[model samples]
Structures are given as C-alpha cells and as structure tokens.
Target: MNKFEIFTNELLKWNKTHKLTNYNEDEIKKQIEDSLYPLEKIKDSKTAIDIGTGAGFPGLILAIAMPNTKWYLVEPLKKRYSFLNYIKTILNLKNVEVIRDRVEKANLPKVDLITSRAVMKTNDILKIIKPFLKKDSTILLYKGSNVLDELQDIDASIISRGNRNYLFIKGEKWAK
Candidate 1:
C-alpha cells in the first residue's frame, strides 16, 4: 500500500473514536482531490504553512504532494494535532512540521505560501497570516459556495470545481 493508503487507514481508525473528521473513505478521497486541484495555480514555495489543519485536509495532503517544500501544519485541537504528528512520523516526512497551537500563537516565520481549507473568512485569514507572509507569497484557500460573498471586497482569483471554490490570492495583491 502507498502512503496515502496508510494515511486513510489511520484517519479512518482515529475517526471512529476521536471523530477527527466526519468524512468516510470515499469522502476523504474526494477531499484529497479537491485539495490538490489548485496545485496548478500555486507557485513553488520553499516554506509553507497551513492553518487549522484539521484532519490534515490540505496540509498533510499537500505535504505529501510537495515533499521538497517545508510544511508546517498548525492545529489548536489536541486530537487533530496528535493525528498530524503521528502521520508525519509514520510517513517519514522530513519536510513536515506539526505545530500544536493556533495559527496566531504559533509565531511562525514568514513563508512562501499559506494554505487553509474551510478555516475562516478570506479577510480574517489575511489578518492572521499577515505576519507570516512574504511580498511574493501566495495563499490558496479552499472554500465553499459562499466564497463569492467572502471575496466581495477582496481581490482574488477563483476557480470553481463542483461546489468548491479555490481562492488564489497573491501577496502583492493582498498585502497592499
């Protein structure tokens, strides 16, 4: 079995008890697809951070995809934080750093990219990530149908796949 197979099995086992996620195997597979769909639009980053990496939606998945990039997965909740760390160790992912704290308290350095999935509103995320962004940084937010409402006053590029909205915002566009 591959790493993702192991990841799915572990997630399923933990979900039964800790309820790390409400998604089943098939649903989680769809989420993995949704998480990776925006890779084409993202810039190659040396370091990246994922806020509220609950059940490792895009963080762990992206870490697996982009092993060359350093990834920090932040989760305030204990169960999910444990899961992320466990996955990191099990997968032998040297590029992964599991942070057991809220994004605001993590006090991480500026990174080349920041990602979040269903974490918060676009503007709210910008505020939190302002300190962890470089001028050429990029942000990839996985949002739902209400993404348009969230982006009403925010400048971002959007791509829709099913009901998922991939919001892409360049640091230069948002940092100003």
Candidate 2:
C-alpha cells in the first residue's frame, strides 16, 4: 500500500474513538505535504520535539519520513498519548517517543527542531516552547491561512506558504 493509504488506515483506527483529525483525503494530503516543508531546515537535527501533538499530525508524519532522527511527541492528554503509543507500536516506529505530559511539565532535552500543529496561537506557542528550544533551533508551526496576519505583531522571523507557517524564532540566546 502507498504511504497515504497506510497513514489513513492507521489514523482511521485511532479516529474511530479519538476524533484525531477531521481532514479528508485531499486535506490530509495537504497536511502531510505542509508538514514536510521544514525538512530542509531540520535535516541535520539529531532530535526534534513535537509539542501538543494531538494525534500526531506533523510529528508522527515526520518521524515516519525521517527514521534517522529522534522524535519526541509531547501531549498532555492521557488518552491521546495512549493512542499515540498504540500507533507507534502498530507501525513499528522506533525513532518516535510519546511523552504523556504538557509542554510546560515535560522534561524536554535540548533539540534542534521543534514543531507543532494547531497547538496554540503563534505568540503563545513561542512562550510554550521557549524552554525546550536550543540556541539555533528552528520551529516549524503548521497553521491555516489565518497565520499571516497573526505573524505581523510577533517578534520573530516568519515564512508563510499557503496555509503553513515556519517560525524562525530562535531561543533567546541565539542572535537572529
């Protein structure tokens, strides 16, 4: 089966009970494509932290695509984390680790890449992930079209493509 089919099948199995995502096939395709756009920035990253990974949008997809990199999926909900673990086991994904805790509570190791989808407002997310991001880390936040206007007041460099937004808001220690 193709990757999309496999992804859908796995996601459907989780969605039967968890309401993971409402995206249809085309939407799912778009999400997956958008999730991968940051690969170029995080290519050399040894580890990545995915905050608020509900049902693993960019996290799981990125973990699957980049088997060589370590992925940490940080979610606060117990049931969601359970489902994420189940998916990891079912898919035999070794590089992915699901952390059942909020971004604030989780003991995050320094990572080169930090990513999230539908987690929080652009400004809020920068605060949420401030602790885990390293000096030169790149944050890839997947957002809808509404993000362009949201980026205006934010104190960070941002790139918007279609409905996706990549935030270059490095840790405070880094000189941007």
Name the best candidate (by lDDT).
1
How well does model 2 score by local distance difference test?
A: 0.78
lDDT of 1 by residue, 48-76 (tens): 99999999889899899899999999999
lDDT of 2 by residue, 67-166 (tens): 8899999988887788789878878889999998888889978888888888888778777777777777877777777776667555666667865667
Query: What C-alpha lDDT, on a 0 to 100 scale, does residue 160 get in candidate 2?
Result: 79
Most TM-score-accurate candidate: 1
Relative to the true structure, how large is the alpha-carbon lDDT of every model? Answer: 0.89, 0.78
Tell me how far the alpha carbon of residue 16 in candidate 1 is from the true structure, in angstroms, after superposition: 1.6
Clashing pairs for predicted structure model 2, backbone only: none
Estimated TM-score per prediction? 0.96, 0.84
| Model 2 stretches astray by more than 4 angstroms | 2-4, 152-155, 172-176
TM-score of model number 1: 0.96
